[model samples]
Target: MSRGTRAPRAVRAAAVALALAAGTVVAAPPAGACACGGLVDGPAYDTSVSSETAVLQWDGTTQTVLLELDALSNAPEVGLILPTPAPAEVALADPEVFRELDALTAPRAVVSDHRWWPELGFGSGSDGAGGAAGVAVLGEVRLGPLDVTTLGASDAGSLGAWLTERGFQLPETIQTALAPYVQDGWSFVAARLAPEEAATFDGTLQPLRVTFPSSSLVYPMRMSAVADDTQSTRTYVLADHRVDRVDPTAEAYEPTVRFAGRVDPATVESAELAALLRAGGFVTSHEQVFTEPGTEIVSDFVFAPAAADVAYTPTYSVVADRRIGPFFAGPVLAFAGVLALAVLVIWSGRRRRAPAPTLAPRPAGA
Candidate 1:
């Protein structure tokens, strides 16, 4: 099929179109790969740091995903490892959906001039699933420019050896990092640029779309522990309710909540994303910190059903009063004081200028 073909019409809003518009799925960088399926930092410093964006849409117990990955051109080999809650159907994901998401959720420099007497305001700025394994070769399939395989590793040690044995050039630390998820019974999606398409591999790797049975949305991230330092992640969640906040599960930094707002289905431009957001839901963006070797977040994401009759508020906002109270409070209170002083000064000035009260005119002739 042509690259222009859209994803299944029904799922367009929930997810983006599946497949690259032009060339096959490809990328560069030796990303040891993230347990959450992110690209690991590699020696290829040719390009500046890369950013990945993933889209997740859940229907009941199943989820549709699109992960946008970046790679370099002319790289002989490039591959990715993604852990899943259960078996996954792998295919090329659309790049357009990412454009829509970036467009809708990208941070805006909101200049809120909350000032004294409408004078000024302080500016505010805003911002998966799967299963187990054995030496088990679950399956292999080809989706466009990608050669895909489903893998199951018995344990961390064996899995490391297995990847090396299979010609996957990566470090031992990555293997050690996988221990947690491997011990917890998670499966993986392994993909590489097809040999024939390697030469033409563009920098933008066609996001691989994976669908599977996930009781809750989750991205295996326990393996990211081997990362040299905390990894920065920004994720856009399109779900029925706002996702819960990220905390210091491991030694990683806390996730920053960008925004929790109603989804504008029309803005996203994906039928699937639009419908899903329109159903009384939200699209939340987050900047998170995950320490290597372990994560405070068990799964990258888990669809959190909005608690019944419970009002939901952003935790940061709940504490927002404290945030601006001191900064703006002083200014506003000072402005009030100054304004009061100005009024008093004006009254005194007028009284003094009033020709000594004029003695009530001739009525005081007595």
Candidate 2:
């Protein structure tokens, strides 16, 4: 669900890229306020491929980003990118964490009335390798086949030129797609496969976990326009408060939210995550899925955590404007109550309308 996100131009929410086709462009980046650059191959790489799905977990101080990307093409090299609000500490994360989280936060199906006659069943469910002339180094590390480099650049033009100069191939559209970020002055990361590990990649990329200091949980997605394919992401926010979308003023911004109840203490695996959930009953979960249409991508998923002093008040899942319950009976019961009240009102009105019985017979007798 999380793609917080980058480009062939950057390693955004994890935006690394590789060549898709001879004419394709690629980019990597995930940040706020902009400032990006790249070579001509930059745009082609950025546009070539899209991450099918991602899982994001944020507990205020730490953000764990995990993604499942298709296995790489049999190319000589593949590039990865990640962009963050602050310098990030990254390492390989367990892929199982994502599978567990996905199952944990999926939208629940409700069967309000289970009739005895039938049994109904329902179910649901980067780094960098940055190198260039005039590029200021930020950080660099290697995880698996990726050689990561993080850096800062003055503008997209220079960043573009640098990426091209550093032996990174560029697509024709790289410049136009990356202008805004370069203008916004954001930092980027570049990741490439180690030569020895290149051809042997099994198509399935291992999930990577990145943690950085951000005032709140925010996923940078401004550079997604470089890709020609549809983009989709699911974000799981584990904090006291609910999570939502940023830059609401944008006409096309919309995402669905679900309150994935408190983590049962017995079920949690990570001691640290469990401790965070155990300390306060206020600890709860929220998930938002962005099904962004294949248009110019905008907005970032913004998650706001619960205050340390407050406790959680449960709210059901939201799809569009509808709210599904903590256990699925809430709305059903409310509707039944409304129906009962309407029936009572109609009965009372009927009784009142019946004219009082006349005493005409008694009066005649008198």
Candidate 3:
């Protein structure tokens, strides 16, 4: 009992208009090269002298990072290595580069993630009043208050161990404890007491705050998922190059994406889904379609280009109950068809009655 293909002509016209608008061409980025910096370091554990901050390098740029470890007092060893097996279509994997990352952090905690904020004209707390905006990291951790300046190797190790241990537990259990409280792109400072520290009398220990550098780059992307009649969407945006925000709730979604190459129009599936949307009683202000064209940017790969931009004022309404106006011509066409049939029947009858005699008289006069 599905009423299909009933979208008004106006709706189809609006969709076409959107397609025309997005038709404007755009410049494409170099293909197959990570236009955005790729990963340089890893999932490896750092075991060496711990210091204030560690530095990791990628693309000749150093990223200062910090780790919250386990054990308040143990043989002070801190290691910071970038995780490995980089994403496909990008070449960021270099074990040697990660080793160099380890060498740099032995003397310091990687503070790059926390320190780079000021350069964007966003000033940190140290700057006097009326300074640029600043974001705090490891400020007040669940373990306790953390200080970024004085955080040492021992503190980093304690925090790391605590997180690692929790991760090792049952996956579901781990998620249960953290899922409700965790936010993507969120950084936290965590620590655990060493065996000796654990042996001490039960008491709360002070948390250490740490400072790390942050990148200015932010990329946000949107993707949708549908199951049966219900639909869901998720967005991934780089909070900084190092941090990403993932929002599951259907809220605002806009990601400042790095302008990669334009994809081909052929790659875009079809407007059928969009048509289905209209039939399902959803109205967008505009509709457009795109396709992927043939161009070898890489081996067996091509990007899908946008066909056009859609300008739409959203209107969500029920379609089943909409009333057709009297001025609508559909009913008029049905009425006219009936009237024409009646007129043809009447005219045929009159012609049959008079035609035979008229034909005989005309023949005689001739």
Ranking by TM-score: 1, 2, 3
lDDT (10s digit) by residue, model 3, range 1-366: 000012111111010000000001111111100101110111232111111111111211212111111111111211111111111111112122213322321222222322211123566601111211221222221222111111112232332333333221112222232222122332332222232322332322221212233332111111001001111111111011222222322113322321212123233233422222222221111111111111111111111212432222222333232224533344555677899999999999888898454534566557
Q: Identify the leading candidate in terms of lDDT.
A: 1
lDDT (Cα, tens digit) per residue for candidate 2, span 76-156:
333444445555666665555545555665555544433222225796402234444545677777776666566676666
| TM-score of candidate 2 relative to the true fold | 0.59
RMSD of each candidate? 11.4, 13.4, 26.0
C-alpha-based local distance difference test score of model 1: 0.50
Clashes of 3: 69
lDDT of 1 by residue, 255-334 (tens): 56555666566766666556656754576666565544343544444335444323222432112221245455656777
46 Cα displacement, candidate 2 (Å): 11
lDDT of 1 at 143: 72
Minimal lDDT window, size 10, model 2: 18-27
Question: Candidate 1 versus the native: TM-score?
Answer: 0.62
